[model samples]
Target chain A: MSDVFLGITNGVLYGLIALSLVIVWRSTSILNFAQGAMAMFAAYLGMTMSSHGLNFWACFAIALAAGFALGGLTERVLVRPLYKRPEINSIVVMVGFLGLLESAAAAIWSTAPRTLESPFSQIYFEHHSTTISLSPFALFQIISALVIMTAVGAIFRYTNLGLQLRAAALAPEVARLLGVRVNRLLTFGWMLSSAAGVVAAVVISSSGSIGLSPTIMDGFFVYGFIAAAIGGLESPVGAVVAGLLIGLVQQFLQDYAPSGISSFAPVIILVVALMIRPQGLFSTTKARRV
Target chain B: MISIANLSVSFGAVHALTNVSFDAAKGKITAILGANGAGKTTLLRTITGLEEAASGEISLEGTSLLNMRTEDIARAGVGHVPEGRGVIAEFTVLENLRLGSLAAKVNFQDGLAEQFELFPVLGERRSQHAATLSGGERQMLAMARALIAKPSVLLLDEPSLGLAPLVTAEMMATISQLCEKQSLTVLLVEQNAKSALKVAHDAVVLHLGNVVAAASAQEVASDERLRQYYLGLVDQ
Candidate 1:
């Protein structure tokens, strides 16, 4: 039962990470592998403030803001020139960014990893023989994902700015002629996508998940990628659903064989998903008109 | 009125247009007819800022178009309906139309009812995704979308390409009537010389990226040489 709860909670975290991937991917068509690194940078920045005696909430707010800036800058600078090329080139650039970001992080902060405290450590809930921990930081993770996803959907569907961004991604030349100010829209997409990353990182880090080098972010990145791929890259709802399912699978795998290699769950799910339907489990099969 | 003087452009090594000069009179449908790769689309796009004019001056009603960005040019009033129906396929017909209006920020003029009235079939499928529409319906949507922009001059590139014969005639007639109704200047580019010549007040015959013949639509339509070249056996 505890394992069930653990699987469910962990699934929720991975689901959030997948949602972040979807947010950026749909808008820019760039598979932002560096997204995890950007999140780590924000987390480290947040940690710096927390160590200086700031409250958890303050650190979180700072991290979210930094995420927005980082995303906007990367999109405007690093990714802008690659817009007309095949999307694979963008992915390669993201890998380069991952390396650059990691090195920069190392230069700023020593290579030593540090574990932070969960804000809700003092609070605990128990039912019968099972122990359930509802950490405030973890709650932020679930809630932040929900809120950001809703907001992103709302902006894209209802706002003029969102329409412009959609236009720029789908038909950039048309958007430019329609006065969309496409460059600005691209920058904004990066900002929004990165902001989600920051929130995800803060939530994950707040749960005392930092100090686990590469493991902290890389695990979540792999889970998110699998979730997004399985869910259908074209649909945001599909991404979230896949993320949750993968998270649940990973959670239960840990529960049944507590000593098993937990990292294999996502890979297994990924293989099964690709072999079954490479277009994604939930993607709509659109016919070619011309 | 739009004027292009000494306009020249090259794609790497190939010169597409060299010193092409012409004026599309205001409130007139000036049809530019040519064979494929004659640079008709290139000329329209260059005037509208879609393609850069390498060395030239473009002026709309005596206002300089140089040094302005494409978006700025669009905002200033030049709507282009490119080949293959430039409608955002995933968007609904209504949404596509709304985006057209937002291009220039016109407060309010023609609404959905007007669009439906102009193209009844489009009105019927206003809520449907534009991708689901027939080729002809998409053409109507494209024209109507550009019309809503209230552009002083409309740049239409192959509006009837890939459409059925009956649908093409219907679109041509509708486009002709819309031009008269709106009193809008139009720069039309088409390889379908017959339909283009039928509605045009002025015609420019382009050969090898140069304007070989410039005359009234009637004059160009009646010319024996151009008739033999474009109209062929169909010329009466």
Candidate 2:
């Protein structure tokens, strides 16, 4: 029972990360390999600011702003120049960025993992003589994820800016003909995605004493990639739902299945899910070619 | 007037367009007829700044458009309805129309009323995704999307492709009507020379990458050898 609740909370965090990847992929068709690195970098920035006795929310906000700046800068400096080249070139560039950013984080913050305590209490509740996994911080993480989901949903579904972003992502040539500043929109996509990654990092770290390291987000990045893939890489809502399902499956396997077998659940599920529904679990239409 | 002088474009070892030059007079429809690989689409692409010219120049009202970006060209009052309609299938018709108005730098609200007036069917299905639209509806949406920008020069590429004869005639009529009403300088690229010549005031025929014939639409329509040999038009 506790494992199920744990899975849900953990899944929400994974979904947040998956949403970030989906945001970038939907916009540029490039799986952002540096997403986790960018999130970790921003998390370290928040850690540094908080270490100086800054307000927790203020530091978090600052970290998100930093993520936005970094994402925009990376797009303009690294991604934009390579855009005209073959798609493989952009993939290589992103992989290079991933290595550079991880190394940079290590060089700056050292190889040692530092403590990153959540603002909320980590104490679990007791109900019916059973230990439940719903901690104050865990609940906070779930609510935060929900809020982010709702906000993102509204932005994409209702706003004019969202419409422009969709058009730009789906048909850049057509969008350009319609006077959409596609270059700016692409940059904006990266900025929003990185900011989402920052939120996921902060929330995920706050759930427990998962000490921060240069590669602290490696696991999250992997799960997020799997989650995004399950969603078919085009649907935002699909990514979140898939992330939650993956978490539940992972938790069930860990609690009941053999320890060794549990590790392969995500891969097995990914393969099966892809084979069955390549478009995604929630995808209503096949992705339109630009 | 939109003028192309000695315009040439090459892709590595291949020249897509070679010294092709013509003028699309203001308030007139200039149909560009060609066979496949005749550089009809390439010419429109170059004028819209989608393709870079290796040599020569393009200017609208004496303003040189060389080295200008596509957005800049669009901002300079050039609207392009690319081949395949380029209607964003994911977006609704209203959103597509809104996107076009973005290039015009005007609020779409004012233009939306006018667009709905021009194509009443579009109004009925404005909220529907472009993918759901039929071939004819998509073409109308493409034209409406381009026209909403209120461009001084409209570059239309193969608007009649894949549409039925009646739809093609209606589309051409709408285009000619728009040109007459707006005094729009138009470069209409089409493989349907018969339908195209019916609405065009002037015509340029291309063979390979070079202009093979340039004359009035009637003159080009009347030349049996040129029409038969180049345009694939069989005289009745």
Candidate 3:
């Protein structure tokens, strides 16, 4: 029961990361390899502030703001110029950005791993006899991720700005004809996506499962990427569902599979998913009109 | 009023529009008649600021639109229905209409009944995906989406592209009615010269990226030489 609860909480964090990937992919049609690195940089910046006696909440907010700025700047400076060029150009640039970000983070903060502090306690809720594995901190993480995801969904579905974002993603030229400031909307997508990355990073760090280091999100990135791919890369809701399923399978592997081979489980699942439905589980099978 | 003076647009070495200038009068349908590759679409795109002019001036209500972005031009009261309808196929009819209102920042707090009144079939299929809409229905939806913005200047490209002859006539009639009722300034680009000349007050005929003729619709419609040479109109 404890393992299952922990798995679900962890999966929610992975879902958040996958959601970030989906956001950028749907808008720019580019897989942002530097997203995890950007999140790491933001988390480290928040840690630096917290070390300087700032409260956890303030540091968290600052981290999100830093992530937003980093995302917007990256899109404007690194991505925008290469937008009209081949897809390979953007992919190469993002991979290069990932390397630069990781190196810069290591230079600023030592390569040594550190634990991120949590606002909530890690002790389990005391219910007579049955011990639930979910700590207060874990519960808070799950709730926060769910709430944020719901809010993001609402923004994309209900708001006027959301309408512009969707239009910009699907048909930028058409959106432009309709008076949508497409460039601005694309920048907003990056900002929102980076902020989501910050939430996932903070969640993972607080749980002490991965700890904080420049390379901490490397594994998470792989898992999140696979989840996004399985979710059809375009649907945020699909990404989250895939993330949760991946989390469950991962937990089972950790419990039942050998220690050395458990890490390969995600790859196996990804292969299977690709073979079964390459377009993704959530993607609509749209017929080619032309 | 929209004015273009000495406008020229080139793609690489290929000039799409060369030294073209024309006026679409206030509250009038000005049709652009030409065959394929005649720069009809290019002319409309240039007016909407989607295509940058190499050397010319486009002024709407006396304000220069040469350096403005597409969105800014749209806000300046220009609504464009691009070639192929340009409807976001994934979006529902209602959502597409909402996107139109968002363009000009016009609030339809009173529901989209006004759009429904304009295109009754769109109202019935408001919740359905635009992909499911017939070609004629999609065209009407595209027009409604643009008109919902209440734009003073509307640019339509190939509105009669794939519709049945009867449907094309009905659509053209609706466009004419809108021009009279709302006093819309319309720039209609069409390959169907016969249908266009029937509703348009003025006509600009293009051939090989050049404005070959600019006259009142009736004059171009009556001139057998001009009609046959540029408009593909053979005397009936």
- DockQ of all predictions against the true structure, Cα-based: 0.65, 0.62, 0.77
Global lDDT scores for all candidate models = 0.78, 0.86, 0.88
TM-scores of all models?
A: 0.93, 0.92, 0.96
For each candidate, what is chain B's TM-score? 0.94, 0.98, 0.98
- Candidate 1 runs further than 4 Å off: A1-5, A115-118, A127-130, A209-215, A257-262, A285-290, B107-110, B230-236
Q: lDDT of candidate 1 vs native?
A: 0.78
In angstroms and one decimal each, the interface RMSD of every candidate reads 1.9, 1.4, 1.3
**Taking the tens digit of each residue's C-alpha lDDT, what string does model 1 give over B78-193?**
87888887899878888788787786776434555677788889888988998899899999998878777788888889988998878888887887787788878898998889
- Residue A251: error of model 1 in Å? 0.9
The ten-residue window of minimal lDDT in model 2 chain B covers B98-107
User: Ten residues in a row with the worst lDDT in model 2 chain A?
Assistant: A281-290
Error of 2 at B123 (Å): 3.3
Off by over 4 Å in 2: A84-86, A125-132, A260-262, A287-290, B107-110
TM-score of 3: 0.96
Candidate order by decreasing DockQ: 3, 1, 2
Model 3: CA > 4 A from native: A285-290, B109-111
Give the CA lDDT, 0 to 100, for residue B236 in model 2.
70
Q: Which tens-of-lDDT digit does each residue in B80-154 have in candidate 2?
A: 999999998878898888878865777688888888888889999988999999999999899988888889999
Q: How much does each candidate deviate from the true structure in C-alpha RMSD?
A: 2.7, 2.6, 1.9
| A127-175 per-residue lDDT for model 2 (tens digits) | 8988788888888888988888777767777877777787778788778
